[model samples]
Structure formats: C-alpha cells, structure tokens
Target: MQAQPEKKHSSTCDSKEDSNKLESRYQFCGNALRITRDFSNNLGISAIIWESGLVLCRYFEQEKISFSGKKVIELGSGTGIVGILAILLGGDVTLTDQPVVLNQIEFNVTSNIPVSIIQRSKVSDLRWGKNEDQFPTDYDFILGSDIVYSPHDFPSLIKTLQHLSNQNTIIYISSKMRETMGAIDFHEKLLPQHFNSELVHRNEEKEINVYKVTKKAREQPSA
Candidate 1:
C-alpha cells in the first residue's frame, strides 16, 4: 500500500451524501457492515453498492478463500466493502478508486472495522494505469469487483493489472456479465490474453462471475 497522505480531510458529509445518502447493510464474518451510498456525485456510480461486490464476498466465503497474512489490494473499490471484508479476514488490505471516492470508502472502513483490525485497512486513490507504478508490484492478492463494465477502460485496466502483479500474485475479479457494456468480452477475450484466467465461481441467479487469475508464464526463447 502507498503511504497515507498526512493532510487528508476527515469528511463527515458531502452535499451528495447530505441529500441522497443511503445505507446498504450486509452481514459478514459475524458482523454487520453499513456502507454509505451517495447518488449526486459525478462518479455517483461508485458511491452505490453493486451486487457483484456482494457476490464476490459470498464467493470468498463459500470457497474458503484465505486472505490471512497476505498483502492485498482492491481496484475500483466503490463502497469499499470487498476490501473491508478482506481486512476482516486478516489481510493487510488497500482499498482504491478515484480520488473523489476515497472519503466515502474511508468513512465506511472506519465505521465497520474495529479499531484493532482497522489498522490493517488503508484507503488510496488509484487511477488504473496512470500512476500504478507508484505502488508496489508484489502484492499477494489483487481484487476488483464490477470494474470491467466499460470497454473504454479495458486497455488501461489490463495495463494496470499487469503493472501491479508479479508471477505469484493471485488476482480475483468479480463482474456482472453485462454484455451491453462489454464486461463479458473483457473476461472471455481481453483478460486471457495477458493472464491465465479461470472461472472459479459463478452465481447464475445474480449473473456474476468470479475469475481467478495468475500471471501467464513467459515463454522461454529457443536456445
């Protein structure tokens, strides 16, 4: 995780949260999490809870995915629920999105995580490909939920994934199969071109697919 900035504002509310605020609650790891949603921001989409994120959390529990003692990072963390769950499971987790969403994520993280475990959670701004190099590439696990909805961001997203991963980093991406927005195409076509991807779990009822990805082995040149 990148070093936390010193002058970060402690935001109690924005005009968006002031008027259109809502709480989306969930039970995980025997505790309830209340994620705040704001619908008025320009990036309002990230302020709301998405079903893909919930499905991903369920997948982790059902598969007994272990994040304990691992260095983990989550990209496009909207309400920060997935990364928060990872922290609860003992991962040193960094939750990231555009800068505008950091306050919302920070608010949820502080509210849900107990003081003892909250130190393991960090909130940062990661604009996909632009400044990924500022972060380390040796994370044990990388997570993304509902991040592949737009075809426009695919190249940058793939580049960012490549930049942040090493040979052993395990990447988990959970997305709703939104054919209209090219989410399905990203998994079925673009992602495999860079990583060895496996469809580890699918929730047909929710139309969510969780892919387990690892760096593709580089070919050995002929001697």
Candidate 2:
C-alpha cells in the first residue's frame, strides 16, 4: 500500500519556535493581524519587520485608502506585513522578494490574512535588476518599505521601480529617515525625469516618512 500523505493544518500563527523568533500583533480598522518572522540574518534583511512598514500600515489605515479592485505589487516584501494590509484594503496584491524570503512571505500571508483575501494575493520571487520581465508592469500601485537601505542597490532599485511603473501608476514608499542610507538620496535621484515625489506623511516618533511617487506629465511640443 502507498504511504498516506501528511495532513495539513492552518492556524492563526506558525509553530512555537517560529513565533518565538519574531512576532507582531497589529490592530487595524477593528481587525487584527499577526505577523511572524522566522529566519536568520543570513537569509537577508527580509527576516525582520522594520519601523517603516509599521508606519506605512498605520498611514494607510488612517487615511482609509480604498484599494478596491486595484492591482498592487510590493517590492522587497519583508515579513509581508504591508502586503497583507493591502489585501485587507481590497487590493489584489503580489508580494515579491528574493527566493529565500518567499517562503516567509507566504507563511505570513496564509496565517494572518483570511482565505478570501488570500485568494486574491500571491507571492513571487523578484530580484531587483534581474528577471524584470517576470514581474508585471501594469500595476496600479507599487509599494516599498525600507527598501533603500543600501546605496549600492539604488541603481537597481530605481530601475525596478521604473520597469514596474507607467503613466498611471502610483508608487508609495515608506522609509525610515535615518541619517545614513535614508530614502532622501533615492528621491533626489528620482525627481523631474522619472516621477514627481511628494512627502505624504511623517512620524517623528517613529522617524518614518511616507512618499507618494507619480509619473511626470509629458510636455506638449510647439507646433
């Protein structure tokens, strides 16, 4: 006889060890979200949840942004907290990160989000500057949180953002305003030519800034 397959179970959290690693509970719009992060630093920065992610999520809830039927993509989705919140706001979301972090993204999405919302969301492996064709370019909203920490990756990060955005796309980036490696440098490199940058929200307590990036309007030529 063939061996029976192992049974699968679903719960509000992952295993005990995983919860012990890094667990966060959030209450948004009367709904609760629990995100678990379980990975070593060797896997990459995606193993931890940053202050920018938390600030962004709070801003979204406070503003009550309606994402109904919107297509959104999150780049460098660590712990997938922001992507999960996007799904809660009714956006069809794709959470993308490096291959090593995809499993953690899926785990958080499955454990925290409801089945209906999870059905409209997915996890994908996307490396900046490479395999650009693999990701969709027609997203209405592009999201990134704490993705600009390294100046070395700035070029690739900008390239990825440009590849994913079009005339009608809006990109929201939440970054901690650190003296070193903050997003101001990245914004300086993005203005006038690529997109119009607006500082939408700032929280001094958390030291996070939320920026809204929109495509620049084309200039009309003289006859």
Predicted model with the maximum lDDT:
1
Off by over 4 Å in 1: 1-19
Q: Each candidate's TM vs. the true structure?
A: 0.89, 0.85
lDDT of 1 by residue, 122-168 (tens): 99989977989889999999999999888989999999999999899
Q: Each prediction's Cα RMSD?
A: 8.6, 10.8
Model 1: lDDT to the true structure: 0.83
- Reference-based lDDT, each prediction: 0.83, 0.79
Flag clash pairs in model 1. Answer: none
Question: Residues 87-191, candidate 2, lDDT per residue (tens digit)?
Answer: 988899999998888888888899988875678899998899997677777999999999878888877887888888888998989888665874566766644
